[model samples]
Target chain A: MRRWLAAHWRAFSATLARFAGAPLTSLLNVTVIGTALALPLGFYLVLSNLQGLARDYSPQPQVSIFLNIDAQEADVREITQRLKSQPGIAGFRFVPRDQALKSLQSRTGLGDVIAGLGQNPLPDAFVVDAGRKATALESLRAEFARWPKVAEVHVDSDWARRLDSLLALGRYAVLMLASALALALVAITFNTIRLQILTQRDEIEVAKLIGATDGYIQRPFLYLGSLIGCTGGAVAWLMVWGALWVFNGQLRPLAELYGIPLTLAHLNGSDSMATLLFAGGLGWFGAWLSVRRHLHHYNPS
Target chain B: MTQIVLSGVHKRYPGGHEALANISLAINAGELVFVTGHSGAGKSTLLKLIAAIERPSTGSVIVNGQNIGTLRARGIPFLRRHLGLVFQDHKLLFDRSVIDNVLLPLDINGFDRREGTRRARAALDKVGLLHKEKAQPITLSGGEQQRLCIARAIVHRPAILLADEPTGNLDADYATEIGVLFRDFNQVGVTVVLATHDMQLAARLNPRLIEVRAGRLAA
Candidate 1:
């Protein structure tokens, strides 16, 4: 094992020199891979933060139920007590018709028309606030629908449903984009490794000729490919952070629109580790596939 | 007893072209042998079979007490370690220096770096190019590069040496020098097989000749 490691080190050092031997080509290949990886990473950052904002600023649901004008004061008190007792129901507001008419008259420039003919024409109404998710308001809507004195059930935050759908669609789009870019990244690395293999074909075949095991011959290239991939993944992570930094100013107002206090999330420790391992695994697999294909076709005999 | 034996070894490509036909021969240890024929004959094929680079389509080949015809993929590398081989083009890694080239076989055979380098340098000394150890193979003349390849082949001290027209790429002067170098190695008890159609070098070496014609041994 010691001897194998010694030989492997020499092999690795030799391959490193050879890889860095062509400086311009190596740089170009790595940059191409890094850029391919960055697109999805950047999009995912934006999409993830948007989803977070959607969750953080989600409004509390409120339902307004207009009561029958003929309903007595005792009925209103009974409804209030019932609304408070239900699970996930914070409370309700009861507005008498006289108070409602008075506000309307003052705001609509009809305040002094013989004091609105000495009678309030508006119906009494109540406001219901949901204590939890917007879905929790559905029971209130149903209760209002079943009420004999209620005219309508109006949920103020129902439009948030459309926003939820949009956020979900955005997530799917980002995932699709990320997957496509990852494929492009794999191809870029594979093609670069393929070209490198082509140039080293003679040496590789000669190695086989001289009794180098397939694994022994494959070790250095696997390291080379993984180094390139993990380096690209590191660059992708940097691009993700850089893009978020540049867009931090714009994101604040967007957060304000939803009354959310959302912050940008760069690749975390888990993501960085995942990226490094993914890049290394991707590179190793690509090179292994390439070498296997070549060895099958390569006839040193 | 014969150290290298082939009994009715036949190799046919999947496309149905026969590379060798019923080849049966015996070579004693320490004997210098020449596999000679026109182009397209089975000389190279025979060498490949013995090295386990390719298996026989039919029959068996036994070399150094092992049946090479049945050797699997993993066994191929092991088979190559017991023999040193050279090619018509010299097949040297041009990116490496002369000493790096010589140290390659020993490196594969699992020698320590110091010992591998020491043996590689000594092998270069044998080929009379100890001073050129640091020079890139491309920097050397065709003759010097071929000598470097020979040094690399013998560096691990394998008991058998296989050459497929080792001097074919060199000029007459270099070719003659290479021929003399092989003669000296043969004198030192390395079983040598020189596969060549260069009738003149064959006559000079005066080795036991095994001729092939159209994939069959021609007496």
Candidate 2:
């Protein structure tokens, strides 16, 4: 076990030396891989932040049930009781006709005109917070419209439904993009290892001739690939973080326009760890493939 | 005891060229034998067959009691670990320091780092190249590089040592020096098999000689 660990440590250090030997090339390759990975990762972050904003700020799907102008206090109380009993209704608030009239008068700055009319033009209304599903909210609106003394029911959840669908589509897009870029990462590592094998052909042949096992010969290359992958993953994480920081600065004005606090969340610890491991695994696989294909060709003869 | 044996061995390359045909030979433990032949007399093929680098086209080539013809790919490295090989081209890693070239086989075999370095230095000292241990192989002269190859091969202290044209590019002094080195190792009971066309070196060493001509043994 000690020897095994030493051998692996040697391979790892050898890989690091190789990177140090060719810093510019290693850096360029890592940059290319990191940039490619950052595209999907950035999009994913954006979609996640958008979903979070939608969750935090988007109002619940509400159905406003307006009563007839002749609706009495008894009718209002009866409808309130019915709404409370509705299974799908999350909650409801009652606005009496007089309260509604006063609100409109203050909001519109038409207090004198409303007072001159000698009557409250606005009807009593019940705003019901229903679940966010468009179909469920529409059905509830229709049911509320059928209630006695209810003149109309309005569903204000169309824009919310559209935003939800857009976010779902964005999530799918991020997934597909991530899948394609992951393949690109693997291919990049594969080609890099292939070139490394070719350049070290003499060293490999000599090592094999000296009784190096297949595992011994391939360890350094595998380490090289995985190191590149892991470094690239770290680079991608940094790129995403830097981009989010810049984008958040730009989004502050838009968030103020909507009068809501908005900021994109950086990759959590688990997500950052997953990215590094995923990249390292892909790199290891690529190196394995390249070595399996090429190492046999250098038999000591 | 027989350390290597060949019975009815034949080797044919991909282009239908026969490198060796109907050859049979054996060398006992601790024997220093020279394979003498012209440039294309299949001397290297004989060494390669003994080393398990190439299998016989027909019949068996056995080393250390294991038949080379039936050795698995995975078993080849283990077989080779017990044998030291010197190629005609030296096969030294020019990118590494001289000591590193000697340390490779030990590294491959997973010897402890400090122990491997000690052995590597001892091997280099034996070849009189200890002072040049830090220099790159490419900086060495032809004879020095050949010595480096020998140091690398013998660093693991294998039971059998095989050399292909070890003195092919050396001067008379260097060639005699190498021949003496082989004799010294053989005296210490390491079986040595060397292939060469240099009859002068062969005559000077006066060890057992097997001559080959046109892919067949010359009796």
Candidate 3:
């Protein structure tokens, strides 16, 4: 165990030494890789932070169940009791036509025009709320439309469906971007490692002559590639975080106007760790491929 | 105690060049032997076969009790660990310091770094280049570079040391100095096989001399 630790430690330090040896080339590779990674990551941050704001800002779709204009007080009491007893329905409230008209008169400039009609022609209604998710509210709206004496059912979840479609599209776009950029990361690291192997061909020849195993020959390159990837991941994460920090300041007044507590979601610890590990894994894979292909040409005989 | 034995070994390249043919020989442990032949006479190929760098097309090459013909890819490094191989061009890593070049084998074998440094310095001292330990190999003269190669090869203390024309490019004085170094190593119980076409240099050392002509041992 000690020997294994020692060998890997040596490889790691040697990797750092090699990276330090050519500072400009290493910096160029890392910066390019970091920029590629940050693009998709920025898209993901926007999508997640938008979802966070939507959770608080958008009210769930409510089905306004209008009864016949002659619905009695006894019928209203029975319907309210039935709605409260239903399992899927969260809650409902009774809204008399007169109360609805009065609220609309105060909210709009058409109060005198509305008062010109001496008789209240509007019907009594119940606003029913199910769970906030689109699918549930949609199904509840459908169920409520079939209720006895329900003269009309007004479903306002069309905007919610549109918003959901947009979110889905954004999600797929982010996924596609991430996939393409991940490949770019792998290719960039592969090319860099290949160049490194070419430069170190003489050293590899000497090491092989001295009985270095294939594993030993490959160790430092693997570490170097992974270190580059991990550092790039950190750089990308910081780029996204910095962009959010700056944007969040601009978004504050808008969020305040909407009366919704809103802030952009930065990557948490596990997310950051996963990103680093994923990038490092891709870098290691690239190194492995290049090393396997190129090392065959070097024969110590 | 035979350190190397060859029985009916044959090597034919992909382009139909026969590099070796039906060669058979043996060297005992702790012996200083020389394989002397002109260019393309198969001396280097013979040493490479012993080092398991190339496989024989026929028969066997047994080095230190392991058959080169049957050794797998993973077994090559383990086989090489017991042998020190020196190239005609020295093959020194110019990017590293003299001491780091010597430390290559020890590092590959996972020796503790401090211990590896000590052993590397000792090997450098043996080659009379201890003062140049911190210098880059490219800065050294040809003879010093060759000596550095020798130090690296023997840093791991292998049982057999194989040199393919160790003095090929050296002047008479430097060649003689390297020959004496081999003799010194042989006296200390490391089997040495120094392959060279320089018959005069081989003659000066007066080790057991074998000649190769057109891929077979000449009688």
lDDT values for all models: 0.81, 0.91, 0.88
Considering the two chains of model 2, state its CAPRI-style docking category.
high
Q: Pick the candidate with the highest TM-score.
A: 3
**Candidate 2: deviation at residue A38, Å?**
2.0
Tens-place lDDT digits, model 1, residues A1-301:
9987887788778767876898888677677777777887777777677676666666677888887778888878767776677667777787788888878887988887738478776788887777767667787689777866667788887767778788779778878986777777677767777887788788877888887788777777777778778877887787777878878777798979977565688877887798778876777777777777665555587
Candidate 1 CAPRI category: medium
Per-residue lDDT of A173-193 in model 2, one digit per residue for the tens?
989998999899888999999
Strongest candidate by lDDT: 2
Error of 2 at A230 (Å): 1.8
- For model 1, the TM-score of its B chain against the native B chain is 0.96
Candidate 2 residue pairs that clash: none
What ranges in model 3 sit over 4 Å off? A252-263
For candidate 1, list the clashing residue pairs, or say none: none
Chain A TM-score from candidate 1: 0.77
> Which numbered prediction scores highest in DockQ against the true structure?
2
